[model samples]
Target: MTNPPEKTPENPWGPQNSSPEQPFGQQPVQGQPAADPYGQPQYGQPQQPAADPYGQPQYGQPQQPAADPYGQPQYGQPAAQDPNAMANPYAQQGNGQPGYGQMAYGPTPALTSWIKRVGSHLIDWAPITIINRITDPMIGGYDYASKTERVGTNPTLGFILLVVGFAWFIWNMVFKDGKTGVSLGRQVLGIQLVNADTGQPVGAGKAFLRQIAHILDTISCLIGYLFPLWDSRRQTFADKICNTLVIDTK
Candidate 1:
């Protein structure tokens, strides 16, 4: 007679339990949702999306910019400016081009007064005049009919001195004044003659032409020389023609 095997007890729970066929884990029943290995939503329930690890926008979405710490003008916005900007008194105007009474580079200097100009003129001509007067007794007078005009005993010496005086006048008034913007007379008076446009010395060539332009000053009963008295910019006719200005340096 063989001994009968004892009957094994059946599991009260579902078939998702450990059994001889499923040795390691539970097996889901057929036609039912399987349990998630990592605790996901089960079947017949709405699923929640997985959270992004980097916190970035999803695909096909426009990226957002980070917030700015300081308040500043953004792209395509006008910049803010101070409303009460102070004006500069010496600032140039109109593209920095010289106008009738403007300077090309620096601020317009103070004009030389008419009296100062007269003093400078006298100083420049005083030496020449003195030499002429001293030699007048020896130089010959011009004879219109005879064409022979030797009246003094030392005519040759007097003529040489007169030529020397003219040379001195040209050297001081034209070359020196042109190169340095001042002559011996203007230096003593603390004034200078400069180009109105450049505020610099006119070259020797222009200086010589300016001297010839003085004829315009005397042509109109010396009114051009006196223009500085009432003229706005203190420019004579010659000064206007030559585009020069006499400015006080002191």
Candidate 2:
């Protein structure tokens, strides 16, 4: 057999070492630089001049801290509060209704008319006048011009008339008015009397006081009865003094 080529100092592994077991090309010599398999500098090729120690992306250059893209709370920081939330406990509810202790707006109640009040007054007094007319014969039957004139002449009959009248007055004005804040005439007229401040029936005592106060309204040139035409509460002088209001129930 022919002798294999001898190894030399320049080619230490012999000429057989020239062809390497590489995939695409021949292998490098021992002290010679090899080609880059990817056509670029190989690992031992001068190391790219030490990478320009202070070049392009230099160390200690200010790098902005990564921004929080989702506004999430930082590790050691408290989250901010929403400013639009309600602060009051009694504010309107989520369903739009008023909360506790809040008053809702409503239509105001209607006041009684002056004409109806006059009609009620006439109806209330008709029975008293009729009673006096019927009892006139018992009290000497004198044809007097007015009730006061007739009562002035017959003292015994006057006393009897007074008691009966007082009883009727209490039944109509005090008991009935107190119980329902309505007399027969007021009931007919679809109106009611109420304590001005409370919007409720006046009691017996208040009803009595209210009746007694009527004399003042009568003596005021009958102007008191006409007051309800323009009055805000539809009150006469008696109603004002009695702290009462006349409202239309219908």
Candidate 3:
């Protein structure tokens, strides 16, 4: 068979000159991307810099740039700030002398001498006094629980009352749904007992301790319990011995 004919060059860009034989006057490795003077992607596109929503510039640290002669923001910067206003929006400040130690000065309450607080509902459990003919059905004074009747009643009735009273107080101060002091009664009465210093609710533990200390209040035939009769805040001896206070939870 005859060999195929050899191709002849046609133009100056052909192999007849120094140019290599390739399609369309191209060179080898033609797929590489073009580089710029600085060797970055270019075409009127710019390198992006981050910015805050208000177009303010931010850095790792707060800016303390030189101020203008008129004490305003530099020509291209944001608005100036007032020193008397809030410097940091999140920083906490208060109305007090600027120092590490802040002192609260005011008149202490005049009634500080009386610390014990009790619910008015305790009156419900107390022996009620009868004056008129006694009519109310829920707590009619004609019953044995009436104060006048209970006061001069037979010794047996008084003994039973003493038992009931102790039980009532004991149940009130401790052992009620992990809380102390006639829970529902006090809740309905809009009162609560708390530690004086911590301002926390009185719990079963403290209630138990307080109940055990009632012996001191009963020292003089429980005459001290009635001492609140003469005192201003009406706190009994047991209340003072314990560092507790009753407050209007409502």
* Best-performing candidate as measured by TM-score: 1
Candidate with more favorable, higher TM-score: 1 or 2? 1
Q: In candidate 2, what residue range of length 10 has the lowest lDDT sum?
A: 49-58
lDDT of each: 0.84, 0.77, 0.53
**Per-prediction TM-score:** 0.56, 0.51, 0.33
Better of 1 and 2 by lDDT: 1
lDDT of 2 by residue, 62-81 (tens): 54345478866666778766
**Candidates ranked by TM-score:** 1, 2, 3
lDDT of 1 by residue, 151-212 (tens): 88698888888998999889999999999989899999999999997788998988888989
Candidate 3, TM-score vs. the true structure? 0.33
Per-residue lDDT of candidate 3, residues 1-250 (tens digit): 9999998757675453333444655554444444455646645667555455764556664766654678667767778677777465344357543434333344422332222233343443443223111313323233455445322324455445556655655565476612644455555665666666655566787767766666776786876666665766555666577666555544
In candidate 3, residue 20 scores what lDDT?
Answer: 41
Off by over 4 Å in 3: 1-172, 177-182, 230-233
**How much is the lDDT of residue 145 in candidate 1?**
73
The most accurate candidate by lDDT is: 1
